[model samples]
Target: MRQNLSVEEALEAILEGARPIAELEPLPLAQAYGRTLGAELSARVSHPAADDTAVDGYACREADTRGASPENPVRLRVVGLAPAGQPFSQEVGPGQAVQVFTGAPIPLGADAVVRVEDTRREGEFVWLLRPASPADIRRRGEDLVEGQTYLHKGDLLTPARVGLAAAMGHPVLPVVRRPRVGLLTTGDEVVEPGEPLPYGGVYNANSYTVAGLVEEAGGEPVFLGKAPDSPEELRTHLAQTQGLDLLVTTGGVSMGERDVVRKLLEAEGQIHFWRVRIQPGGPLLWATWNGLPLLGLPGNPVSAMVSFLLFGRPLLFRLLGRSDPPYQQLRAVAETRFEANPARRAYRRGILRWAGGYRVASTGSQSSVVLRSMAVGNALVVVEAGKPVRAGEEVEVIPLPGGKTAG
Candidate 1:
C-alpha cells in the first residue's frame, strides 16, 4: 500500500497507468444511442448532392431577372416543373424558366431562384417582379461534404450525432463495448432493502447508488450482492466476478477490524493506494485483483457516492476512450462563510443561484454521513486545503448532473 496522497496526486496515480479498453462492437444506428464511437466516421455522401432550391420558386438565369421590376416585369416561358426528388429534364435558357419547389434540384443553366411570391404565373408564361441572386441556391456539400470526417472517435452517440450518422448513410456504427463492472457492497450489518432489518442493521443503499452511477458512467453493472464480514465469504463474492472489466465495492475499506476489502486485495493481488487527501472520501482505496482494476469506497452513503463521482466515473470514461466528458469548473459567490480542513480539500453541497454572478448557499451541515444535503444540492462548492472562504467571496464550484453554475 502507498502513503496517503492529495486528491490530485491520488487521481494522477490512479490514471497514470490506465489504458482504454480495446473492445469494439458493431451496432445498428437505432441501438447505438449512448454508445461511444470506436473510430472516426467519414461522411459517405455529400448532403444535398446537387444544387437545390431553398423555397418554392422559379429557377431561371440571374441575368433574365435583371432590370425586372413590378412596373415592367420580364416575361419568361415556363419550360417544365421540378418538385423535390423530380428534376426537370430540360435546362433553363434565356426567356425560359422552370417551376421549382423547396429541396428540388436546381434546373441546369439556372443561376438563381426567384421566389414564387416574386413572380406572376399564367399558363406557360411567368413574369419576374424582382431581380434574383445566385445566393438563393443551396449548393452541394453545403451541410456536409463527402469524404470529410463528421464524427470522431470517443464521441457519445447523442440524438444529433445519430441523425448525422443517418444522413451520412451509415446504417451501422462501430462503438466501444460498455465496460462490465462488478459491484459488491461489503458489510455484515448491511441488509438488502425490503428484507427484514435486524437491530443495528442498515439497508444496503450503497449498492443501488453505485449501480446507478456505474450505468450513467457507461458501464454494465454486474451486481454481486453484499459481501459478509468473513474473509472466506468475501473471497466467495470476489470469485464470482472473474471476467468483469473492473470491480467496485462500497464499505470494508476503512481502517477498522472489519475492513476486509483492503486486506483481501493486498493479500490476493496488489493495493496501489489506500487513502486520498480529501474530506468525506479520505478512506478511498484503489487496487488490482487478478488483472482487473478494483476501487473500494468508504461505507458511508455520501462518501461512497462522492468518491465514485470523483474517481470511478473518470475511470469508466477512460475505459471508454473519452479524453473529456463535459465536467467543468466555474466560479461562484458564497452566500455563507465556510471553514476548510487544514490538510484536505472539501466538497460542500450547495444550491447555486444566478444573480449577476452565481451565488451558492450550503444545503446544510457538510458532514460525510449526511446524504440529504447531497440530494438538494445541484453544485459542489469546492474549497482548497487550508483556505477559509468568507461570505460573498468568489469560490470554485463543480456543477452536478442538474446545474445552474455552468454555461
Candidate 2:
C-alpha cells in the first residue's frame, strides 16, 4: 500500500476509482431543487404562443392613426374588447379598433397598439390623439423557442433552473438518485450523546460531523452506530454496509495497538493507501472491502472533519455526477504570524475577510482536539512544511462550505 502521499496524490487516487450512480428517478419540479439532472431537457412549447399586447391599449392599424393629434384627432369605432387569454376573432379594418388588455393577443389585421391613456372612448367610438407603434407587442416565441434544449445532463437544478423547466412545460424532472453512505465510528472511549458520560469518555462527535458533511455533498448518510475497538465488533458493523454506495469510518486507522480497523483492512480489504503527508489528519486511509469503497479518517474530532472536507466531499460529488471542484482555494494576505510544522503540511483554521483585499488570521490554537477552532473559523490557511509565514505574507486559503467572508 502507498504511504505518506501528498494531498493532491491522495485525492487523485480516491477519485480515480469513483463511479457516478446510475439509478434515476423522476421528481416533481418543486422537489427537484439541488438535485442533479439525469437527462437533457428541451422546451415543449414556445412562450407567448401568439403576438400579444404588452400594455392596456387599443389595437388598430397604423395608417388609421397617421397625422392624429390633440387638435386633429382620428375617430374609430371600438368593435370589441380582448382580455388576457382571449383573442379577438374578427379582423380590425382601417376605420375600426379593438380594446386590448395586457397579454391579450393582438386582433387580426391590426399592426400597432396605442396606450389606453393616449385615447378617449365614448359610446363605442375611440379618438386617437397620437400615432401608435408596433414596439408595444411581444412577438411569439420571443422568450423561449419550442424544442430548444435549455438544460443538459449533470446540471444542478437550482431555483431559477427549476422555474425555467416549469416554464418549458415540464411538471417533473429526471434526477440522479442520492448515494447512500454508511457512517461508523470506533473507540471504547466514545459514547452516544445524551447518555451518562463516564470519566475519561467522550461523546461521538465525529458521526454527526461526518454525517452532516455527507448530507451537504448530496449523499444520504446511514448511521451504522459506534463500535468498540474489537475486531469482532468492527467486522460485524462493517457487514451492515451491504447495499450502501460508500463506507466511512473514524478512529482505529493509526498504528496504535488498538487500531483494529487498519488491521482488518490489511487482512481482508484492499488497501490503496495509508497515511497522507498532512498535519492533524496524517492517518487518513483509503481501501475497499467486498467491492465497496471505504475511507478511514483519523480519530481526532478536528482531524476527522478536515479529512472529510478535503477527501470525502469530493468523492460524494463524483458519485452525484457533479463536476464541482473539491474545494475552493484563494490567495490572501496573512494578518498575523503563523507557525510552521517541519515534517508535514499544516492546515490552520482562520477567519477570512475582504478589506481592500483578502485577509486571513489564525483562530487561536491549532490543536487537533480543539473542535471550537472550526466553529469560529471560516477558512483554512495552508502552510508548506518547514516554512514559517510572517504577517503581511500572501498565503493560500480554502474557504469552508457555507462560509461567507466579511467585507
Best by TM-score: 1
lDDT of 1 by residue, 300-370 (tens): 98899889888888888888997566366889989997678899898888888788888888887888878
Kindly state the number of residue pairs that clash in model 1.
0
- Per-residue accuracy of model 2 over 281-352 as CA lDDT, tens digit each: 999999999999999999999999999999999998899888567679999999998888898899989999
- Note each model's CA RMSD in angstroms: 2.1, 3.0
> Where in model 2 is the C-alpha error above 4 Å?
53-79, 93-102, 110-136, 355-357, 388-390
In Å, residue 344's CA in model 2 sits off its true spot by: 3.1
Question: Which predicted model would earn the best lDDT?
Answer: 2
Evaluated against the true structure, the overall lDDT of model 2 is 0.93
Candidate 2, run of 10 with poorest lDDT:
318-327
Q: TM-score of each candidate?
A: 0.94, 0.88
In candidate 2, how many Å is residue 291 off?
1.2
